[model samples]
Target: MTRFAPFLLLALVACGDNDPRYLISAPAETGTAGQVALRVATLEVRQVSLPAYAAEDEILREDETGALKPVQGALWADTPPRAMTQLLADRIAARSRAQVAAEPWPLSTPAQALVDVRVSELAARLDGQMHLTGQFAISSPDQIVRERIAPFAIAVPLAGDTPAEIARATGRALEQLAEQVIATLRR
Candidate 1:
């Protein structure tokens, strides 16, 4: 009976339809005391490119040339990853001890720093590869401050057959990506 009780709780939690709030929410972070003039280099999310043939069948597939073809799922502007960027920006606002701002404006001259990210790959495979990678770059007006390769992924079971399941999987993958991006900014 004790074991069954725990299982019941697990089943109930698993049945939840509520998408995680953090996945889409990016409320502004509280500010710290500082006057450092820091501006978030308008992150240009290079429209995560992918081969056109990817849409014909499953997204996660390989080519005859033996290269692992990347996948391009929905580029929903309001997706978790985009929101995660806002979350990171919020965190940077606090952590950087510099006034942080995010938007589409390009710097007229040169900002004090920049954060550039290249989305190399993102998607869940039929075999559960769930690969995502990006290169991070931080630059001062004069020189690059940091550069690194960050990736996030996981291979869970193929048990749940549903779009929501895949969305959840992608969300989980992006969460890892969020962590990586945060780490890059910290360094």
Candidate 2:
């Protein structure tokens, strides 16, 4: 029994809590479901640029001191840049007549327009709001559509400080951004 005790302790240590809990930012809800006219038929979305903290796997929260802190035991289910790029493409496509895809431009034919988004801030703030601020530019290689650079700042009230609530707020913010982008494409 004494010899087995050592092995039992080792097994217990190995089974201890070392794995991080992964949280997913839910896909943006399809808002006002209807196709809107777009200047371009095919749109390519470049990889989104996220802030250093925002790009990290650890979920961060802005504390009262205005410093970002990681939420212990919580990690993002997917890479932020890739996830956000795909999210934007999906959201935009659902709301517009255009077919949108994340870059590498899946189709053999060239895309009519390209979208690049740079996110300066994306965080759950101390004030119980999820803030998303950034600039997005649309360009056309063949001049099929007019080029434009638009800035966006979105905030969604957080129901609670939990990671799940933060993710929900993030989704809502992205939904708002998608709507704004679609509106721009309509012009």
Residue pairs clashing in model 2 are none
> Model 2: per-residue lDDT, tens digit, 1-187?
9999999999999998664655445564566578888988999999999989899988889888889999877777778888788888888988888889999899999999999989999999998999999999989999998899999999999999887787778877887888888888894
Per-candidate Cα RMSD to the true structure, in Å, reads 13.5, 4.3
Show where candidate 2 strays beyond 4 Å.
Answer: 1-33
Total clashes for model 2: 0
Give the per-residue lDDT digits (tens) of candidate 1, residues 1-187: 8979989999999986543221322333354653233234333222222333322233233345556453344223344434545544555555454444444434565455555545555544555445555455555555444444444333444334344454455455544544454455552
Task: Give the lDDT of residue 5 in candidate 2.
Answer: 98
| Model 2 lowest lDDT segment of ten | 19-28
